[model samples]
Target: MNKHNSSHIYGIRSILEAIIAEQPINKIFLQKGLKGELFMELESAIRKNGISVSYVPIEKLNRLTRNNHQGAVAQISPVKFHVFETLIESVLASEKNPLFLLLDQVSDVRNFGAIIRTAECCGVHGIIIPKNGAAPVTDDTVKTSAGAAFTVPMAKVDHLKDALFYLQSSGIQVVAATEKAEDDIYAVDFNQPSAVIMGSEDKGISPSILNMVDYRAKLPLMGNIGSLNVSVACGVFLYEAVRQRINQI
Candidate 1:
């Protein structure tokens, strides 16, 4: 097993140690139908820590380790979380019109990383994603982001709808980018403080979160393909904001 400072643990004893150490586990993978006293103990510890776990085949666990992962492996995050209010307060203190991105179920790690890179290029003050539904910011996500992930402020909130409501109260217009929208994205002015919300490719934004958006705008798609990749679409909106912000200068 590869040594890690963040407590990468395997089957029974390691998992129990991780739980006892109070280390934050990004995720745990357990082989399905693995019956053992240790397995049950690890399962109990995992639940007590509130860590998310997935059941996979023993082969999958073997792939993660040549030695004994005991049908279990855990991935950990490198950074501590940031609070949404702290990010908002920092933006307000800067006296700049806060530009933000709220991601709704964008599970693709590369796409999420690319979006963060674009958001940084466009001068986005912060990026918000639901704590549960978003992509894992693993080593791959950070590598794909090309260090932009470190430079940008990211907040993971428990509920996206409530986060939108908070942003609205803070004077940031929440705009939803969906193909079902009635207006062109270009028609909306980005000079004002704004937050743009993008959804997963499989299903657009969830209705409850969609309803919270102040504006719904769509990009003009003339190609045979009806939609763009979420990362590319995010770049379009972010640069539009950049263009408008530049024009004002």
Candidate 2:
């Protein structure tokens, strides 16, 4: 296996070493039904770092690396994931109005890249994604982002529903984007300190999270397409914030 794969960390020792060195690990995959001292050590390291991990079949681990991964592989992120509390503190301390983007299980790497590019260009203070289920930043993602992925500040959180609550408690209006919503994008007040949650391409926002939203807004579609691509929808949502902030609309 190429040591330069950027996304993968093969072998149990190497994975543990990376964690010990404070590498930005996106996720870890372990072979199902496997247990040993090394595995226990790895699990402890993962818990200590709060890294997302999954138990998969050996075949899946083999597919990721032909090298002796020792039934474990870690995915390293290209950019260091920001700390949510630190990011919020900094944003709140800033003189400018806060504009944050919270992504809910948008699993496509290319889409993640595009959203990062758009969010950076739109001057979003930060991007928040769930630690599990979200796509890891890879070379393809960086290329798709036009290098914006490295510049944009992003926080990987434990759960998205909890994130919405935190944002609300911090005095930021939390708006969710969903087709089932009664209001269009214009109805929400984005000029204030705000965060907009964009769901995955397939499934929209979770019902529990959607229920907690201060507002549910949609982009009216005049065309025949049932829905827009998640990245495109994200761009539209962010630019609306830019427009609102520019015009104080």
TM-score of each: 0.84, 0.92
lDDT of 1 at 83: 81
What tens digits encode model 2's per-residue C-alpha lDDT throughout 22-104? 88888899999988999999999999778889999999998998888888988888889888988988889983689999989
- Model 2 scores worst on lDDT over the 10 consecutive residues at 1-10
* Maximum-TM-score candidate: 2
List candidate 2 stretches off by more than 4 Å: 1-5
- Residue 43, model 1, lDDT: 91
Q: Candidate 1 at residue 208, lDDT?
A: 89
Kindly give the stretch of ten consecutive residues in candidate 1 with the minimal lDDT sum: 1-10
Q: At residue 51, what lDDT does model 1 achieve? A: 68
Per-residue error for 210 in candidate 1, Å, reads 1.0
lDDT by residue (1-249, candidate 1, tens digit) is: 233444356656776776687655667889999898988988998876556788999888777766677677876665445688888888888957889999999998889889888888888888988767678777777778898888888887778988988889988899999998989899999988999999997897998887779999999999899899999999998888889889999
Off by over 4 Å in 1: 1-8, 11-24, 33-50
TM-score, structure 2 vs. true: 0.92
